[model samples]
Target: MTRKAPDAQTLSLMLDNVKFDSNGLIAAIAQQHDTGEILMLAWMNHEALEETLQTGRVCYYSRSRQNLWRKGETSGQTQQLIEARLDCDGDAVLLLVDQTGVACHTGRKSCFYRSFTEDGLKEISKPEIDPGQLYARPHKH
Candidate 1:
Protein backbone atom coordinates (compact mmCIF):
# COMPACT_ATOMS: atom_id res chain seq x y z
CA MET A 1 0.00 0.00 0.00
CA THR A 2 1.22 3.47 -0.80
CA ARG A 3 1.48 6.04 1.97
CA LYS A 4 0.70 9.67 1.50
CA ALA A 5 3.51 12.14 2.03
CA PRO A 6 2.98 14.84 4.57
CA ASP A 7 1.96 18.24 3.32
CA ALA A 8 4.35 21.16 3.52
CA GLN A 9 2.51 22.76 6.46
CA THR A 10 2.40 19.46 8.31
CA LEU A 11 6.01 18.77 7.61
CA SER A 12 7.04 22.22 8.76
CA LEU A 13 5.11 21.85 11.99
CA MET A 14 6.60 18.45 12.70
CA LEU A 15 10.14 19.61 12.01
CA ASP A 16 9.66 22.66 14.21
CA ASN A 17 8.59 20.46 17.09
CA VAL A 18 11.86 18.51 17.10
CA LYS A 19 14.49 19.81 19.52
CA PHE A 20 17.98 19.44 18.14
CA ASP A 21 20.83 19.50 20.59
CA SER A 22 23.60 22.11 20.77
CA ASN A 23 25.37 20.52 17.83
CA GLY A 24 22.23 20.71 15.71
CA LEU A 25 21.59 17.02 16.13
CA ILE A 26 19.21 14.66 17.90
CA ALA A 27 19.68 11.13 19.14
CA ALA A 28 18.00 8.63 16.84
CA ILE A 29 17.21 5.07 17.77
CA ALA A 30 16.47 2.41 15.19
CA GLN A 31 14.30 -0.53 16.13
CA GLN A 32 12.98 -3.55 14.33
CA HIS A 33 9.44 -2.66 13.43
CA ASP A 34 7.80 -6.03 14.00
CA THR A 35 10.04 -7.56 16.64
CA GLY A 36 10.72 -4.43 18.68
CA GLU A 37 14.40 -5.25 18.75
CA ILE A 38 16.62 -2.28 19.40
CA LEU A 39 19.04 -2.27 16.51
CA MET A 40 21.27 0.76 16.96
CA LEU A 41 21.54 4.31 18.15
CA ALA A 42 22.74 7.09 15.89
CA TRP A 43 22.58 10.85 15.49
CA MET A 44 20.69 12.93 12.99
CA ASN A 45 20.95 16.49 11.76
CA HIS A 46 18.16 18.52 10.23
CA GLU A 47 19.04 17.59 6.68
CA ALA A 48 19.38 13.94 7.47
CA LEU A 49 16.05 13.85 9.20
CA GLU A 50 14.38 15.67 6.34
CA GLU A 51 15.87 13.33 3.79
CA THR A 52 14.78 10.28 5.72
CA LEU A 53 11.27 11.61 5.83
CA GLN A 54 11.31 12.43 2.17
CA THR A 55 12.95 9.29 0.90
CA GLY A 56 11.74 6.62 3.34
CA ARG A 57 15.30 5.50 3.96
CA VAL A 58 17.18 5.83 7.22
CA CYS A 59 19.92 8.48 7.29
CA TYR A 60 22.12 9.70 10.09
CA TYR A 61 24.71 12.36 10.77
CA SER A 62 28.10 10.72 11.23
CA ARG A 63 29.78 12.46 14.12
CA SER A 64 33.11 10.87 13.25
CA ARG A 65 32.93 12.04 9.66
CA GLN A 66 30.98 15.25 10.30
CA ASN A 67 28.59 14.54 7.43
CA LEU A 68 25.37 12.79 6.55
CA TRP A 69 25.73 9.03 6.81
CA ARG A 70 23.12 7.03 5.01
CA LYS A 71 22.67 3.66 6.67
CA GLY A 72 23.85 0.71 4.58
CA GLU A 73 25.62 3.01 2.17
CA THR A 74 28.76 0.92 2.39
CA SER A 75 27.34 -2.21 3.90
CA GLY A 76 24.29 -3.88 2.36
CA GLN A 77 22.19 -3.53 5.50
CA THR A 78 19.82 -0.72 4.65
CA GLN A 79 16.84 0.30 6.77
CA GLN A 80 13.43 0.97 5.29
CA LEU A 81 11.51 3.44 7.40
CA ILE A 82 8.30 1.95 8.73
CA GLU A 83 7.61 4.82 11.05
CA ALA A 84 9.25 7.81 12.74
CA ARG A 85 8.37 9.17 16.15
CA LEU A 86 9.53 12.02 18.33
CA ASP A 87 9.93 11.64 22.03
CA CYS A 88 7.81 13.64 24.45
CA ASP A 89 10.60 16.16 24.92
CA GLY A 90 11.33 16.18 21.19
CA ASP A 91 15.03 15.58 21.89
CA ALA A 92 15.05 12.04 20.57
CA VAL A 93 13.68 10.15 17.59
CA LEU A 94 12.55 6.56 17.39
CA LEU A 95 12.69 4.95 13.99
CA LEU A 96 10.69 1.78 13.37
CA VAL A 97 12.36 0.17 10.43
CA ASP A 98 12.49 -2.94 8.33
CA GLN A 99 16.21 -3.57 8.45
CA THR A 100 18.00 -5.48 5.73
CA GLY A 101 20.65 -7.98 6.85
CA VAL A 102 22.54 -7.15 10.08
CA ALA A 103 22.38 -3.76 11.71
CA CYS A 104 25.74 -3.58 13.45
CA HIS A 105 29.01 -3.12 11.61
CA THR A 106 30.47 -5.95 13.65
CA GLY A 107 28.22 -8.34 11.69
CA ARG A 108 25.83 -8.79 14.59
CA LYS A 109 22.10 -8.26 14.28
CA SER A 110 22.15 -5.49 16.85
CA CYS A 111 24.77 -3.19 18.29
CA PHE A 112 23.76 -3.99 21.89
CA TYR A 113 25.44 -7.33 21.87
CA ARG A 114 27.66 -6.77 24.90
CA SER A 115 26.13 -7.25 28.31
CA PHE A 116 27.35 -5.90 31.61
CA THR A 117 27.37 -8.67 34.12
CA GLU A 118 28.95 -9.58 37.43
CA ASP A 119 31.80 -10.95 35.37
CA GLY A 120 32.19 -7.57 33.69
CA LEU A 121 31.34 -6.77 30.10
CA LYS A 122 30.66 -9.93 28.15
CA GLU A 123 29.76 -10.45 24.54
CA ILE A 124 26.38 -12.16 24.67
CA SER A 125 26.18 -12.74 20.96
CA LYS A 126 28.56 -13.86 18.26
CA PRO A 127 28.86 -12.23 14.91
CA GLU A 128 26.49 -13.69 12.34
CA ILE A 129 28.86 -12.67 9.55
CA ASP A 130 32.48 -11.63 9.47
CA PRO A 131 33.02 -7.91 10.10
CA GLY A 132 35.43 -7.66 7.22
CA GLN A 133 32.71 -8.87 4.85
CA LEU A 134 30.24 -6.15 5.79
CA TYR A 135 31.92 -3.31 3.95
CA ALA A 136 33.55 -3.37 0.54
CA ARG A 137 36.13 -0.78 1.54
CA PRO A 138 37.45 0.79 4.73
CA HIS A 139 34.75 2.84 6.39
CA LYS A 140 35.10 5.49 9.06
CA HIS A 141 33.20 4.16 12.06
Candidate 2:
Protein backbone atom coordinates (compact mmCIF):
# COMPACT_ATOMS: atom_id res chain seq x y z
CA MET A 1 0.00 0.00 0.00
CA THR A 2 1.14 3.53 -0.68
CA ARG A 3 1.91 5.72 2.27
CA LYS A 4 -0.39 8.64 2.94
CA ALA A 5 1.05 12.13 3.02
CA PRO A 6 0.38 14.55 5.84
CA ASP A 7 -2.53 16.91 5.61
CA ALA A 8 -2.28 20.72 5.64
CA GLN A 9 -2.16 21.14 9.40
CA THR A 10 0.28 18.31 9.85
CA LEU A 11 2.29 19.49 6.89
CA SER A 12 2.45 23.00 8.24
CA LEU A 13 3.88 21.63 11.47
CA MET A 14 6.27 19.45 9.55
CA LEU A 15 7.65 22.48 7.74
CA ASP A 16 8.97 23.68 11.05
CA ASN A 17 11.37 20.77 11.01
CA VAL A 18 12.90 21.77 7.68
CA LYS A 19 16.07 23.82 7.89
CA PHE A 20 16.40 26.19 5.01
CA ASP A 21 19.78 27.66 4.22
CA SER A 22 20.73 31.28 4.78
CA ASN A 23 19.40 32.02 1.31
CA GLY A 24 16.02 30.65 2.41
CA LEU A 25 16.41 27.68 0.14
CA ILE A 26 16.82 23.96 0.63
CA ALA A 27 18.10 21.25 -1.68
CA ALA A 28 15.38 19.01 -3.02
CA ILE A 29 16.51 15.81 -4.68
CA ALA A 30 14.14 13.87 -6.84
CA GLN A 31 14.32 10.08 -7.09
CA GLN A 32 12.22 7.49 -8.83
CA HIS A 33 9.78 6.13 -6.32
CA ASP A 34 9.85 2.48 -7.28
CA THR A 35 13.20 2.18 -9.06
CA GLY A 36 15.20 4.40 -6.70
CA GLU A 37 16.83 6.16 -9.63
CA ILE A 38 18.19 9.61 -8.86
CA LEU A 39 16.41 11.90 -11.26
CA MET A 40 17.51 15.45 -10.54
CA LEU A 41 18.48 18.00 -7.96
CA ALA A 42 16.79 21.35 -7.44
CA TRP A 43 16.25 23.98 -4.83
CA MET A 44 13.06 24.94 -3.02
CA ASN A 45 12.01 27.86 -0.97
CA HIS A 46 9.39 27.61 1.77
CA GLU A 47 6.61 28.57 -0.60
CA ALA A 48 7.76 26.08 -3.19
CA LEU A 49 7.96 23.38 -0.57
CA GLU A 50 4.48 24.19 0.65
CA GLU A 51 3.17 24.16 -2.88
CA THR A 52 4.69 20.75 -3.51
CA LEU A 53 3.17 19.39 -0.31
CA GLN A 54 -0.19 20.82 -1.19
CA THR A 55 -0.31 19.94 -4.85
CA GLY A 56 1.60 16.65 -4.96
CA ARG A 57 3.52 18.04 -7.91
CA VAL A 58 7.24 18.73 -7.66
CA CYS A 59 7.92 22.49 -7.50
CA TYR A 60 11.34 24.08 -7.31
CA TYR A 61 12.97 27.49 -7.06
CA SER A 62 15.17 28.29 -10.00
CA ARG A 63 18.28 30.14 -9.02
CA SER A 64 18.80 31.67 -12.43
CA ARG A 65 15.25 32.89 -12.78
CA GLN A 66 14.94 33.70 -9.11
CA ASN A 67 11.44 32.35 -9.09
CA LEU A 68 9.38 29.21 -8.64
CA TRP A 69 9.70 26.68 -11.42
CA ARG A 70 7.25 23.85 -11.65
CA LYS A 71 8.92 20.82 -13.20
CA GLY A 72 7.73 19.98 -16.70
CA GLU A 73 6.03 23.34 -17.00
CA THR A 74 7.79 23.96 -20.26
CA SER A 75 8.62 20.39 -21.12
CA GLY A 76 6.16 17.51 -20.64
CA GLN A 77 8.17 15.51 -18.13
CA THR A 78 6.13 15.99 -14.99
CA GLN A 79 6.93 14.38 -11.68
CA GLN A 80 4.19 13.17 -9.35
CA LEU A 81 5.19 13.13 -5.74
CA ILE A 82 4.94 9.81 -3.92
CA GLU A 83 6.80 10.86 -0.81
CA ALA A 84 8.72 13.83 0.64
CA ARG A 85 11.37 13.23 3.24
CA LEU A 86 13.44 15.67 5.25
CA ASP A 87 17.08 14.88 5.76
CA CYS A 88 18.44 13.99 9.17
CA ASP A 89 19.85 17.49 9.58
CA GLY A 90 16.78 19.00 7.92
CA ASP A 91 19.04 20.82 5.47
CA ALA A 92 17.86 18.87 2.46
CA VAL A 93 14.84 16.94 1.20
CA LEU A 94 14.31 13.76 -0.73
CA LEU A 95 11.42 13.54 -3.15
CA LEU A 96 10.22 10.13 -4.22
CA VAL A 97 8.20 10.61 -7.35
CA ASP A 98 6.78 8.98 -10.45
CA GLN A 99 8.55 10.74 -13.30
CA THR A 100 6.46 10.78 -16.45
CA GLY A 101 9.19 11.61 -18.96
CA VAL A 102 12.83 12.66 -19.27
CA ALA A 103 14.00 14.46 -16.16
CA CYS A 104 16.95 16.24 -17.68
CA HIS A 105 16.88 19.36 -19.86
CA THR A 106 19.05 17.45 -22.33
CA GLY A 107 16.14 15.02 -22.90
CA ARG A 108 17.85 12.29 -20.90
CA LYS A 109 16.28 10.20 -18.15
CA SER A 110 18.49 11.91 -15.57
CA CYS A 111 20.88 14.82 -15.29
CA PHE A 112 23.52 12.48 -13.94
CA TYR A 113 23.98 10.63 -17.23
CA ARG A 114 27.71 11.26 -17.37
CA SER A 115 30.10 8.65 -16.00
CA PHE A 116 33.71 8.82 -14.95
CA THR A 117 35.65 6.24 -16.95
CA GLU A 118 39.25 5.06 -16.69
CA ASP A 119 40.30 7.45 -19.45
CA GLY A 120 38.18 10.45 -18.58
CA LEU A 121 34.60 11.71 -18.20
CA LYS A 122 32.09 10.05 -20.51
CA GLU A 123 28.58 10.93 -21.67
CA ILE A 124 26.67 7.66 -21.55
CA SER A 125 22.95 8.39 -21.73
CA LYS A 126 21.72 9.77 -25.01
CA PRO A 127 18.85 12.17 -25.32
CA GLU A 128 15.58 10.38 -25.91
CA ILE A 129 14.01 13.50 -27.39
CA ASP A 130 15.23 16.85 -28.55
CA PRO A 131 15.14 19.50 -25.84
CA GLY A 132 14.01 22.07 -28.39
CA GLN A 133 11.02 19.84 -29.15
CA LEU A 134 10.24 19.31 -25.49
CA TYR A 135 10.42 23.03 -24.74
CA ALA A 136 8.74 24.29 -27.86
CA ARG A 137 6.21 26.36 -25.98
CA PRO A 138 7.11 29.28 -23.78
CA HIS A 139 7.04 28.66 -20.03
CA LYS A 140 4.60 30.72 -17.97
CA HIS A 141 4.66 28.80 -14.71
Candidate 3:
Protein backbone atom coordinates (compact mmCIF):
# COMPACT_ATOMS: atom_id res chain seq x y z
CA MET A 1 0.00 0.00 0.00
CA THR A 2 1.17 3.52 -0.75
CA ARG A 3 1.99 5.52 2.34
CA LYS A 4 2.14 9.22 2.94
CA ALA A 5 4.68 10.58 5.34
CA PRO A 6 3.14 11.28 8.71
CA ASP A 7 3.24 14.75 10.19
CA ALA A 8 5.91 15.52 12.75
CA GLN A 9 3.60 15.31 15.73
CA THR A 10 2.26 11.94 14.67
CA LEU A 11 5.73 10.66 13.96
CA SER A 12 6.99 11.87 17.30
CA LEU A 13 4.19 10.04 18.99
CA MET A 14 5.12 6.89 17.12
CA LEU A 15 8.76 7.24 18.08
CA ASP A 16 7.90 7.76 21.68
CA ASN A 17 6.20 4.38 21.70
CA VAL A 18 9.15 2.43 20.41
CA LYS A 19 10.85 0.19 22.95
CA PHE A 20 14.52 0.40 22.20
CA ASP A 21 16.95 -2.06 23.70
CA SER A 22 19.51 -1.26 26.33
CA ASN A 23 21.89 -0.31 23.53
CA GLY A 24 19.33 2.27 22.41
CA LEU A 25 18.67 0.49 19.16
CA ILE A 26 15.97 -1.70 17.70
CA ALA A 27 15.95 -4.49 15.13
CA ALA A 28 14.64 -3.45 11.75
CA ILE A 29 13.74 -5.89 9.02
CA ALA A 30 13.62 -4.62 5.48
CA GLN A 31 11.49 -6.38 2.89
CA GLN A 32 10.71 -5.78 -0.75
CA HIS A 33 7.44 -3.90 -0.75
CA ASP A 34 5.75 -5.67 -3.61
CA THR A 35 7.30 -9.09 -3.45
CA GLY A 36 7.41 -9.27 0.33
CA GLU A 37 10.84 -10.73 0.12
CA ILE A 38 12.98 -10.38 3.19
CA LEU A 39 16.01 -8.32 2.25
CA MET A 40 18.12 -7.85 5.34
CA LEU A 41 17.98 -7.11 9.02
CA ALA A 42 19.79 -4.26 10.67
CA TRP A 43 19.87 -2.17 13.80
CA MET A 44 18.34 1.28 13.94
CA ASN A 45 19.08 3.80 16.60
CA HIS A 46 16.70 6.61 17.47
CA GLU A 47 18.34 8.93 14.97
CA ALA A 48 18.14 6.33 12.25
CA LEU A 49 14.50 5.67 13.01
CA GLU A 50 13.63 9.36 13.01
CA GLU A 51 15.52 10.05 9.81
CA THR A 52 13.93 7.08 8.06
CA LEU A 53 10.45 8.16 9.06
CA GLN A 54 11.11 11.73 8.01
CA THR A 55 13.06 11.15 4.80
CA GLY A 56 11.41 7.93 3.57
CA ARG A 57 14.82 6.37 3.17
CA VAL A 58 16.04 3.46 5.26
CA CYS A 59 19.01 4.25 7.49
CA TYR A 60 20.68 1.76 9.80
CA TYR A 61 23.08 1.86 12.68
CA SER A 62 26.34 0.21 11.79
CA ARG A 63 27.44 -1.75 14.82
CA SER A 64 30.81 -2.38 13.25
CA ARG A 65 31.38 1.14 12.04
CA GLN A 66 29.82 2.70 15.14
CA ASN A 67 27.98 5.19 12.94
CA LEU A 68 24.83 5.76 10.99
CA TRP A 69 24.85 4.02 7.63
CA ARG A 70 22.39 5.14 5.02
CA LYS A 71 21.24 2.35 2.76
CA GLY A 72 23.09 2.50 -0.55
CA GLU A 73 25.41 5.22 0.74
CA THR A 74 28.39 3.49 -0.83
CA SER A 75 27.01 0.60 -2.88
CA GLY A 76 24.26 2.39 -4.79
CA GLN A 77 21.73 -0.12 -3.49
CA THR A 78 19.21 2.09 -1.77
CA GLN A 79 16.09 1.02 0.05
CA GLN A 80 13.36 3.58 -0.40
CA LEU A 81 10.81 3.20 2.35
CA ILE A 82 7.30 2.44 1.19
CA GLU A 83 5.98 1.91 4.70
CA ALA A 84 7.22 1.33 8.22
CA ARG A 85 5.47 -0.86 10.77
CA LEU A 86 6.29 -1.37 14.40
CA ASP A 87 5.76 -4.73 16.02
CA CYS A 88 3.06 -5.21 18.63
CA ASP A 89 5.67 -4.91 21.35
CA GLY A 90 7.18 -1.87 19.67
CA ASP A 91 10.60 -3.48 19.93
CA ALA A 92 11.01 -4.36 16.27
CA VAL A 93 10.31 -2.62 13.00
CA LEU A 94 9.39 -3.86 9.57
CA LEU A 95 10.25 -1.74 6.58
CA LEU A 96 8.52 -2.21 3.27
CA VAL A 97 10.82 -0.73 0.69
CA ASP A 98 11.45 -0.31 -2.99
CA GLN A 99 14.89 -1.75 -3.25
CA THR A 100 17.33 -0.52 -5.86
CA GLY A 101 19.95 -2.85 -7.30
CA VAL A 102 20.96 -5.23 -4.49
CA ALA A 103 20.56 -5.17 -0.73
CA CYS A 104 23.40 -7.42 0.38
CA HIS A 105 27.06 -6.55 0.79
CA THR A 106 27.74 -9.84 -0.97
CA GLY A 107 26.04 -8.44 -4.10
CA ARG A 108 23.00 -10.66 -3.67
CA LYS A 109 19.48 -9.32 -3.96
CA SER A 110 18.94 -10.06 -0.28
CA CYS A 111 20.99 -10.96 2.75
CA PHE A 112 18.92 -14.09 3.22
CA TYR A 113 20.55 -16.10 0.47
CA ARG A 114 20.82 -19.28 2.42
CA SER A 115 18.18 -21.65 3.65
CA PHE A 116 17.95 -24.74 5.76
CA THR A 117 16.50 -27.77 4.07
CA GLU A 118 16.19 -31.46 4.67
CA ASP A 119 19.65 -31.79 3.27
CA GLY A 120 20.94 -29.19 5.70
CA LEU A 121 21.99 -25.58 5.09
CA LYS A 122 21.80 -24.80 1.40
CA GLU A 123 22.74 -21.87 -0.74
CA ILE A 124 19.44 -20.83 -2.21
CA SER A 125 20.59 -17.89 -4.30
CA LYS A 126 23.71 -16.76 -6.07
CA PRO A 127 25.16 -13.29 -6.07
CA GLU A 128 23.81 -11.26 -8.95
CA ILE A 129 26.82 -8.94 -9.01
CA ASP A 130 30.32 -9.03 -7.64
CA PRO A 131 31.15 -7.07 -4.50
CA GLY A 132 34.15 -5.55 -6.24
CA GLN A 133 31.96 -4.39 -9.08
CA LEU A 134 29.42 -2.91 -6.71
CA TYR A 135 32.03 -1.07 -4.65
CA ALA A 136 34.32 -0.14 -7.48
CA ARG A 137 34.97 3.33 -6.14
CA PRO A 138 36.90 3.69 -2.93
CA HIS A 139 34.73 4.69 0.02
CA LYS A 140 36.25 7.27 2.30
CA HIS A 141 35.08 6.95 5.90
Candidate 4:
Protein backbone atom coordinates (compact mmCIF):
# COMPACT_ATOMS: atom_id res chain seq x y z
CA MET A 1 0.00 0.00 0.00
CA THR A 2 1.16 3.47 -0.84
CA ARG A 3 1.51 5.95 1.99
CA LYS A 4 1.01 9.64 1.38
CA ALA A 5 3.06 12.42 2.88
CA PRO A 6 1.44 14.67 5.42
CA ASP A 7 0.30 18.15 4.39
CA ALA A 8 2.58 21.05 5.18
CA GLN A 9 0.56 22.27 8.13
CA THR A 10 0.26 18.81 9.59
CA LEU A 11 3.94 18.21 9.12
CA SER A 12 4.78 21.41 10.93
CA LEU A 13 2.60 20.50 13.89
CA MET A 14 4.03 17.02 14.09
CA LEU A 15 7.57 18.33 14.00
CA ASP A 16 6.87 20.86 16.69
CA ASN A 17 5.48 18.21 19.03
CA VAL A 18 8.51 15.96 18.87
CA LYS A 19 10.87 16.38 21.80
CA PHE A 20 14.36 15.75 20.59
CA ASP A 21 17.08 15.08 23.09
CA SER A 22 19.81 17.58 23.86
CA ASN A 23 21.80 16.02 21.06
CA GLY A 24 18.91 16.77 18.66
CA LEU A 25 18.08 13.12 18.28
CA ILE A 26 14.99 11.00 18.95
CA ALA A 27 14.66 7.26 19.36
CA ALA A 28 12.86 5.58 16.48
CA ILE A 29 11.61 2.03 16.65
CA ALA A 30 10.76 0.28 13.41
CA GLN A 31 8.22 -2.51 13.44
CA GLN A 32 6.63 -4.76 10.86
CA HIS A 33 3.29 -3.29 9.87
CA ASP A 34 1.45 -6.57 9.52
CA THR A 35 3.16 -8.90 11.95
CA GLY A 36 3.89 -6.44 14.74
CA GLU A 37 7.44 -7.66 14.89
CA ILE A 38 9.95 -5.01 15.83
CA LEU A 39 12.61 -4.76 13.15
CA MET A 40 15.14 -2.41 14.61
CA LEU A 41 15.86 0.59 16.76
CA ALA A 42 17.69 3.63 15.46
CA TRP A 43 18.17 7.32 16.08
CA MET A 44 16.63 10.04 13.93
CA ASN A 45 17.46 13.67 13.74
CA HIS A 46 15.20 16.39 12.41
CA GLU A 47 16.37 15.97 8.84
CA ALA A 48 16.02 12.22 8.92
CA LEU A 49 12.53 12.42 10.45
CA GLU A 50 11.39 14.98 7.91
CA GLU A 51 12.74 13.00 4.99
CA THR A 52 11.02 9.86 6.19
CA LEU A 53 7.70 11.65 6.56
CA GLN A 54 7.94 13.27 3.16
CA THR A 55 9.22 10.30 1.18
CA GLY A 56 7.58 7.40 3.03
CA ARG A 57 11.01 5.82 3.20
CA VAL A 58 12.67 5.14 6.53
CA CYS A 59 15.75 7.23 7.23
CA TYR A 60 17.90 7.35 10.38
CA TYR A 61 20.83 9.21 11.83
CA SER A 62 24.02 7.25 12.26
CA ARG A 63 25.50 8.19 15.61
CA SER A 64 28.75 6.58 14.58
CA ARG A 65 29.02 8.27 11.17
CA GLN A 66 27.44 11.53 12.36
CA ASN A 67 25.26 11.66 9.25
CA LEU A 68 21.91 10.70 7.84
CA TRP A 69 21.69 6.99 7.15
CA ARG A 70 19.19 5.92 4.53
CA LYS A 71 18.02 2.42 5.25
CA GLY A 72 19.17 -0.14 2.68
CA GLU A 73 21.43 2.37 0.90
CA THR A 74 24.04 -0.35 0.64
CA SER A 75 22.08 -3.47 1.47
CA GLY A 76 18.78 -4.46 -0.21
CA GLN A 77 16.84 -4.19 3.04
CA THR A 78 14.94 -0.96 2.61
CA GLN A 79 11.98 -0.04 4.81
CA GLN A 80 8.82 1.58 3.49
CA LEU A 81 7.03 3.67 6.05
CA ILE A 82 3.44 2.68 6.59
CA GLU A 83 2.67 4.67 9.68
CA ALA A 84 4.38 6.80 12.34
CA ARG A 85 3.30 7.44 15.92
CA LEU A 86 4.88 9.60 18.56
CA ASP A 87 4.89 8.57 22.19
CA CYS A 88 2.94 10.65 24.69
CA ASP A 89 6.15 12.18 25.95
CA GLY A 90 7.17 12.85 22.34
CA ASP A 91 10.66 11.59 23.07
CA ALA A 92 10.33 8.56 20.85
CA VAL A 93 8.61 7.46 17.65
CA LEU A 94 7.10 4.19 16.54
CA LEU A 95 7.41 3.48 12.84
CA LEU A 96 5.29 0.80 11.28
CA VAL A 97 7.03 -0.25 8.08
CA ASP A 98 7.19 -2.76 5.30
CA GLN A 99 10.64 -4.23 5.57
CA THR A 100 12.40 -5.72 2.57
CA GLY A 101 14.98 -8.42 3.10
CA VAL A 102 16.69 -8.53 6.50
CA ALA A 103 16.43 -5.58 8.89
CA CYS A 104 19.55 -6.45 10.88
CA HIS A 105 23.03 -5.90 9.49
CA THR A 106 23.85 -9.37 10.74
CA GLY A 107 21.43 -10.69 8.05
CA ARG A 108 18.69 -11.46 10.54
CA LYS A 109 15.06 -10.48 10.06
CA SER A 110 15.15 -8.30 13.18
CA CYS A 111 17.81 -6.76 15.38
CA PHE A 112 16.32 -8.16 18.58
CA TYR A 113 17.37 -11.71 17.89
CA ARG A 114 19.36 -12.25 21.05
CA SER A 115 17.70 -12.92 24.38
CA PHE A 116 19.01 -12.78 27.91
CA THR A 117 18.12 -16.19 29.26
CA GLU A 118 18.96 -18.14 32.37
CA ASP A 119 21.78 -19.68 30.37
CA GLY A 120 23.50 -16.44 29.57
CA LEU A 121 22.83 -14.54 26.31
CA LYS A 122 21.33 -16.73 23.67
CA GLU A 123 20.55 -16.03 20.04
CA ILE A 124 16.86 -16.87 19.59
CA SER A 125 16.91 -16.56 15.85
CA LYS A 126 19.35 -17.55 13.13
CA PRO A 127 20.47 -15.43 10.22
CA GLU A 128 18.26 -15.91 7.20
CA ILE A 129 20.88 -14.56 4.80
CA ASP A 130 24.61 -14.22 4.91
CA PRO A 131 25.81 -10.75 5.93
CA GLY A 132 28.45 -10.67 3.19
CA GLN A 133 25.76 -11.02 0.52
CA LEU A 134 23.70 -8.11 1.83
CA TYR A 135 26.18 -5.39 0.97
CA ALA A 136 28.25 -4.72 -2.10
CA ARG A 137 31.06 -3.14 -0.11
CA PRO A 138 32.40 -3.45 3.42
CA HIS A 139 29.92 -1.80 5.77
CA LYS A 140 29.73 -1.02 9.46
CA HIS A 141 26.53 -0.49 11.41
* Alpha-carbon local distance difference test for all models: 0.92, 0.92, 0.92, 0.94
Residue range 1-141, candidate 1, lDDT tens digits: 554557778888899999999999999999999999999999999999988988888999999999999998888789989899999999999999999999999999999999999999999889998988988664442
As for lDDT, the candidate ahead, 3 or 4, is 4
Across 2-60, the per-residue lDDT of candidate 3 in tens digits comes to 56778989989999999999999999999999999999999999999999999998999
- Candidate whose lDDT is highest: 4
Model 1: ten consecutive residues of lowest lDDT? 132-141
Which pairs clash in model 3?
none
Q: In angstroms, how far off is 58's CA in candidate 2?
A: 0.7
TM-score of every model versus the real structure: 0.93, 0.92, 0.93, 0.94
Task: List RMSD in Å for every model shown.
Answer: 2.8, 1.9, 2.3, 2.7
Candidate numbers, best TM-score first, in rank order: 4, 1, 3, 2
Poorest lDDT segment (10 consecutive residues) of candidate 3: 132-141
State the lDDT of candidate 4 residue by residue for 1-141, as single tens digits: 678899989998889999999999999999999999999999999999999999998999999999999998889689999999999999999999999989999999999999998999999999999988988674443
> Model 4, stretches more than 4 Å misplaced?
137-141
Model 1: lDDT equals 0.92
TM-score attained by model 2: 0.92
**Candidate with more favorable, higher lDDT: 2 or 3:** 3
